[model samples]
Target: MRWAPRGCGGTRPSPEHVKRNGWHDQNILVVSPDDQRLTWPERELVRQLGEKLYGTRNISEDRNG
Candidate 1:
């Protein structure tokens, strides 16, 4: 599956974010920002990165995204 943030209008993660998050572009990692497996800083960074790449979620688009 393609890698995209869950609530960020399906924008793909940046290469920098991928490496920082220890992910490869072809890897599929679906985790919530609140996932217990992630540290607080990491979760926060995920949110920040999602926002940086996609601004914010569009409720309308989310129905299909």
Candidate 2:
């Protein structure tokens, strides 16, 4: 499956936002993984992607690492 923002003409995800937020921004398409508009699977995918990209860092881990 392929994903792209409307009118993006095949644009890619925003790396800056992803790095800054410690989460994948999906090219600014996904405002949040918890967005109710997204299907459960989509939300789950976003969460997993975020974890994979940023690592599953907890509050303590963030503070220390």
Q: Per-residue CA lDDT of candidate 1, range 1-65, in tens?
A: 56656676646788658755765655655555656788999998887777787786554665554
Q: What TM-score does model 2 achieve against the real structure?
A: 0.41
List model 2 lDDT by residue over 3-64, tens digit each. 66678676466864555555444334434676797899998898889898888746355544
Q: Which residue pairs collide, candidate 2?
A: none
Provide TM-scores for the models: 0.41, 0.41
lDDT of 1 at 2: 67
- Sliding window of 10 residues with minimal summed lDDT for model 2: 22-31
The numbered model that scores best in lDDT is: 1
Each candidate: RMSD: 12.3, 13.4
Each prediction's total of clashing residue pairs, residues at least 3 apart in sequence or on different chains, is: 0, 0
User: What is candidate 2's local distance difference test score?
Assistant: 0.67
The C-alpha lDDT values of all candidates are: 0.69, 0.67
lDDT of 1 at 31: 53
